[model samples]
Target chain A: MNYPWPDIGTPLDQVATPMPVIDEDRLAANIARAQDYLDSHGKAFRPHIKTHKIAAIAHRQVEAGAIGINCQKVTEAEVFAAAGFDDILITYNILGAAKLARLKALNGRVPKLSVVADSETTVNGLDATFDADRPLTVLVECDTGGRRCGVQTPDAAAALAQRIAAAPGLRFAGLLTYPAAGGAAEVEAFIVGTMALLAEQGIDCPVRSNGGSPDLFSAHLVPSATEHRAGTYVYNDRSMVRAGHCTADDLAMHILATVVSRPAPDRAVLDCGSKALTSDLLGFTDYGAIEGYEGARIVSLSEEHAVVDLGGCAAGFPGIGAMVKVVPNHTCVVTNLFDRMVFHRDGIVTRVETVDARGTVW
Target chain B: MNYPWPDIGTPLDQVATPMPVIDEDRLAANIARAQDYLDSHGKAFRPHIKTHKIAAIAHRQVEAGAIGINCQKVTEAEVFAAAGFDDILITYNILGAAKLARLKALNGRVPKLSVVADSETTVNGLDATFDADRPLTVLVECDTGGRRCGVQTPDAAAALAQRIAAAPGLRFAGLLTYPAAGGAAEVEAFIVGTMALLAEQGIDCPVRSNGGSPDLFSAHLVPSATEHRAGTYVYNDRSMVRAGHCTADDLAMHILATVVSRPAPDRAVLDCGSKALTSDLLGFTDYGAIEGYEGARIVSLSEEHAVVDLGGCAAGFPGIGAMVKVVPNHTCVVTNLFDRMVFHRDGIVTRVETVDARGTVW
Candidate 1:
């Protein structure tokens, strides 16, 4: 039942292929760089742990001056809270009786636990499960151009805040918006308008939370935001590089896949595929970027094989059994694909961390 | 840590949302149907365990008369083999020293274990790891219009078979082809020609393997195929339905998701997203099909939310907290998403099984 990892000083060729690897140096640099940016901007940085799902990395972020951690699901937050991340924000509309009960239990355990809700049903569920003695803090999620989940307008946000404040077991804490990339102006306007409406209703909006990794730097533009939340900054990816957020050097995680089959000169198949790297294109045409193979692109992915077309490569491609590092299109999704991830320092194994919160989607 | 599911006979509304559920009767019917087709065709059936990844379901398939199981990776096969699946065919080119050693160990433990390779590198690795004392059987993967992994021509397949035959610790079993759907003609021509070529060289070809759920019925067209491998048919999905292989009633698995946010009249965001339903569109534009909402189309997906466009629904859509079942575009990828799947018979929970090979990509 034990899965083996290469020893610390073992060569890359000796390590397992199609395994997720994190460059320790690059990871430290990415974490420090992100924290520095938020510190200089005077924003409370709450890095989403959904990116890595590894407690060790989350602990590193906390040590690097992160104010809190953000999780997408209640079960995911439980993993972090159990690992001593006291302040956590579950940025999703949690419903269902079982989940609400779990959330209330998690809220009691964590020192600071906040949840976002765009509708009254979510608010009511939280209120029904939590007690007035240990009131749950609820944030009204706003549709600031995200067009996914949220109250449609600033007015709706204010209305939701009123309901949260009136609920016996809930406290209206803030206005939260996960805006679309480059939608800072809209986020600012929406939050400012909602806060004004809440103020008129004698409700104070203490936290104005805004997020989106693609718009991480431009977060300062939204002055109404008291804190900022973003994931994927801790381990930049191909989508981030294409979004001009970071360069290839900033990518800390890669799927170390070996060329298992070179059936023809043009076609070489890697052991990593949708099951290993994930199928989230995130606006990218190719599945991932093969490091050192400049022109080579991952043409397609089946469940367990990434078929790469070597026709586009200007330089020579790796032969069979030769390992290649693939920067996934979206790094966060790839983290959820595996049960454990290997950490490396200059191609040498450092640690193998279990993805503790993986499959915590419920 | 305890994820509660609704007890037997409990209403569907009471079960946790965003969970994968299986209809026991439908699953049994699907399995029996596929087995019957292969039985009538006089071909040995090898159901791929990658679709369900549950040991119990795999055992049922074997009990229903499957000759063996098909796994995509060595680690995946290990999970099945350890779970009492004595015969297995790993239809992948497994490389790396660690994996080769594991494969050899697994081969010794299992009564019948076979692997496929389309290149000399894979064959050499298998030959080096295994010995004449425990000789390994290898099938030459044929392209057969799949354009993913396989030797190009019959001559190449013949040459590879000759190489495998001459190897010190390898046995040339036959040919394997994961052909493009509806490409039975190509598979037949390639296999028959390769068998003829092998015959001219005094090499006997025992097994001609052709696969894919879409072409399962048409497998009889390939007269040279001794055994057929398929995965998705046991839990028929949207892709299989769209491919004209089955109907909605045949689908056994569905992602049970609750409407968490009704942000607008046209949009309803479900708790399930790419993390639950998967992003494997499998040529389908939408993420999944909501069972009763005929016009509803999954507009987009983030990590934690499935933004469903309710504009198309002729039947009234459910309000927030109301649960709905979603048929994922690709069931295999969806199976890899969740750790446990709930099985039900007559709307009553029967059992909850862990996805034994959920993250066995390596």
Candidate 2:
């Protein structure tokens, strides 16, 4: 459990290469900006902790006026719950007996714990696990445009909500949808239709949740959504910048790496590869972007070496032993790769926080 | 760390979804097969622990006649070393003062420790850290055909080897190359030429190492290489099967996941996603190959959901709550994503071993 992090107040140069570092100043600003933007629209903010997976960062988000936090897995919620956070929403279909047992226990401890279900199987499992005296809140997951999970149509969503409401140990909490990149209009139509159907059935829906980092600022576009959920906004990445959601200046996480080998005039190898960065391309051809090295492309990634083609760069390739900062294509995946992340301000280390929920994918 | 693993003799049906499981019979067979194959060719075998990152598996490889263990990072080697492993070879350029200090400490404890270097910056750091009384063994890494973290030519390797020989606290060991797929001729040529140059310089080349799982059975092609190293052969993956190295039966590792959603007849969603199975496509278009379900493609993966397309399957898609096994594109990266791996025999749980170096990327 000993993380390879330098002491507090240590300079960035003294820290090891291929390590995840967060700019404290930028991190605070990103959290505050997102909360302020959501507050302006009178929308409740529930920042997803999957991006950082650190309890301290989640505390900052809650302190910045977030109503609750979103977790992807049962064990991830347990981490933050142990760290003293109360409100948690797990936006995943909780299946199987084992996970249901854990989820029931987590619900017993947390004040307001909510989960989403898209099918009868998930609803049955949740109903079978909870007791009548303590009903677990359930949200119907609707697939508006994102074709990953959730019910196909608003009618299907209304049916699932009725099923949840009829269950003895489950209470129907409104709707949840992880929309496609620019599918706000579709999300709005689906939620509106589902709500109308529920009205006809005499079911009162309270929470309407919608989220996606690619369309964070435009979350207000979905007028029916009451709360917003987002994970990637905590640490903006190359894909966020490409989506025009956040600029490079708002990027908080950077992989500090050393140029270990210069095998060719146009090629250099970095110590940070797929293990340090991530293989999640997020629609980018290259692995990541070098901060100051414009046009340099990460051609390929071995387990521990990132082969960069410096041919596109107007400036020459970095010499061996030189250090470079790389902005990962997807910062959330990068956060899960490490056990701890170093927080810094103006290139000086402030503290190191353990990624408590890293590898808690189950 | 409390990993979500079931007890001994637990049924596969009882275990949690999105968990990495290894068939104990197949794992033992893989270790024995690779050892016998290398033994028949009169070549020493060094199993890279980066694939499993478990001491029990490393111990099994040693019991199966592996000469030593190979590590990619200093902290990873320290993990195996603490578990009673000696004679470790770290195949990475040891740069920076902090890592060199660690390398020196590891070398002091291990009976025999070696490292690779392709630049003077690495060699100088080693020389500055170690004492002359107990010099560290250094190998010159040649690029051969794998254009990553190595000298481009035999001459440059020879030059680096000579530089290591002259260093105060370093001993030149030999040459090492991680050849490109099917690039045995280039590897042989590079090693032969480098040995000749070292002979002319009166520098003794004791060991020559060459390896890659794709070209594992063709180790004899590089006759100059005294030893061979391979990691993925221990748990053959989809990429290894496509490379004609091992069959589907040789794939020991699998992500046991639950079918959480069946939104469309052609589309089913698995609980496992990029966090369970890696996103390393290698050269495959799909994320992974689903066992028992031919022509099913894992079209996309979110952090917690794997959207599968069963359109091409002759059989209908699996219903919600059904379990499926996934063979990842790259097994090594998959191993890095989990804290513990479940070992089973004939669909019955045997034990769960901790991935000791799970996140020791530093």
What are the lDDT scores of the predictions, listed in order? Answer: 0.88, 0.90
What does candidate 2's lDDT look like per residue over A193-219, in tens digits? 999999999999989999987767998
Please identify model 1 stretches exceeding 4 Å from their true place: B5-10
In the predicted model 1, the residue pairs found to clash are none
Number of the top-ranking candidate, with DockQ as the measure: 1
**Per-candidate TM-score, chain A:** 0.97, 0.98
- Provide the TM-score of chain B versus the true chain B for each model in turn: 0.97, 0.98
Per-model TM against the reference: 0.98, 0.98
Top of the candidates by lDDT: 2
TM-score of 2: 0.98
In model 2 chain B, where is the ten-residue run with the lowest total lDDT?
Answer: B311-320
lDDT of 2 at A353: 89
